[model samples]
Target: MMTTPARIRVAIQIPPSRADYAAIRRAAAQADALGADAIFNWDHFFPLGKDTSGKHFECWTMLGAWAESTSHAAIGALVSCVAYRNPDLLADMARTVDHVSDGRLILGLGAGFREWEAKEYGFEFGSPAQRVQQLGEALHRIERRMTLLNPGPVRKLPILVAADGAKALRLVARYADIWQTFAEDDAFSEKSRLLDSYCDQLQRDPATIERAVFVDGDPWTVGTRLRERGAGMFTLMTRGPDFNLDGLRRWLAWRDEHNAQASRS
Candidate 1:
């Protein structure tokens, strides 16, 4: 099982789309006040939910603002698109944001998808397997570029890779500091176990790569069971421009209660 960072943390995904700047900023403030350990926004060109034409801000730009906006919490994208920009440039951008946040950046990255976004934005959306392969390539490029970038990241920006396929798990062992898997409750144990097995065969220290998951359902019953299986952190995606973090308050309370229990134990 994972250890260190004794108390578990909650990551709140506040994708700022469908509303105005004031609305998005308000939600961000709410997440910060609710004591979330981390705040996140999805990297997408458009809205991912019901509000297709909703007002959405770009990911990196919003994160630059989020860095200065909140204190004492890590911030990241759910997963940035490796296919959209040059990996080296992406690393540079992350380093810049890291400096802006005073070393509070967690670079969650993944292969690019969403063909419509790509086509509309003039990016090539390749096949699924190809995209995953491209993601692995991007990881390699970023790591190398990070060292060469004149002014290094304000902090050693933790690389969070997202994928559950066998190839992706192996890549996680080879490169990732954290593997972020998203799904429902029952599947958490199975995916984590599968990742553990992959870690075993690769002779990579399982502990090196943290296992983090996010759920859209109730945290009480679903999130608790996932935690029992050694899930280290949870994410609740609250979509915005009209973002309300009422759910975040409940989850943070749950996190605080658990942290206390762990301490006493």
Candidate 2:
């Protein structure tokens, strides 16, 4: 059996964009009070839920705001679109945010999706294959620029890339410090196996790539199982006007239970 790590944490994905700043603020403050490890907002022009142009906050800007509000808990975009900003600019922004957060920033990134959002912003909504191709290149440029930046990052920004595709996994192996995946589905086990296979095929130590999965379903049912399948961290995504603070609290309780159980073993 695998030994449990000492710092098991629960994260809350804060959806500030779709909700009011006051509401998002309340959620962030509450989640921090409730002892969440990290908080995030998705990078997008419009809301992914009910409203399109609703009172949505921008990703980096909101993350900066979140940084100021909460003393504890890491803050980041759930997955920033590498396609939106130039790699150097994105690196600088991430670096700046990292400093602002006092090294509590996670640079979660992925290729641009949502063609409508891109077109509205005048960003090229390229084909899926092209986007994936660009994602790898973007990561390379970002890393290079991060090294060349004036102060360097306050801390090595944890590069969190999403998905379990072969190229995605390879990129994760090559550059990412954290591999984020949506292991909430029924087929999560199969995808987890594929992630391991990719690591093996790339000759990268699977343990080096910290698994960061988005939590779905019952925390009690899925929490420990996810850790067993290779997830080192699980982010609970709470969407809407409420932002589900209660749900995150329950999930935190589950994380504590899982950690306690693992410790006893």
Per-model TM against the reference: 0.93, 0.91
Weakest ten-residue segment in model 1 by summed lDDT: 1-10
Best by lDDT: 1
Across 1-265, the per-residue lDDT of candidate 1 in tens digits comes to: 4333456778888876877877777777777777888888888989885657867789989999988888878999988999888999999999999999999999999886688888898988888888888988999999999999989998778999988777777778778888898754556666666777778887877767777888656677766777777777888887654566777777788888889988998
- Which residue pairs come into collision in candidate 2? 17-56, 17-57
True lDDT of residue 146, candidate 1:
96
- For all candidates in order, the CA lDDT equals 0.81, 0.80
Predicted candidate 2 versus true structure: per-residue lDDT over 164-224, tens digit per residue: 6777777887888787876554466566566666777778766776777777778877776
Which parts of model 2 are misplaced by more than 4 Å?
Answer: 1-7
TM-score of candidate 2 versus the correct structure, residues matched by position: 0.91
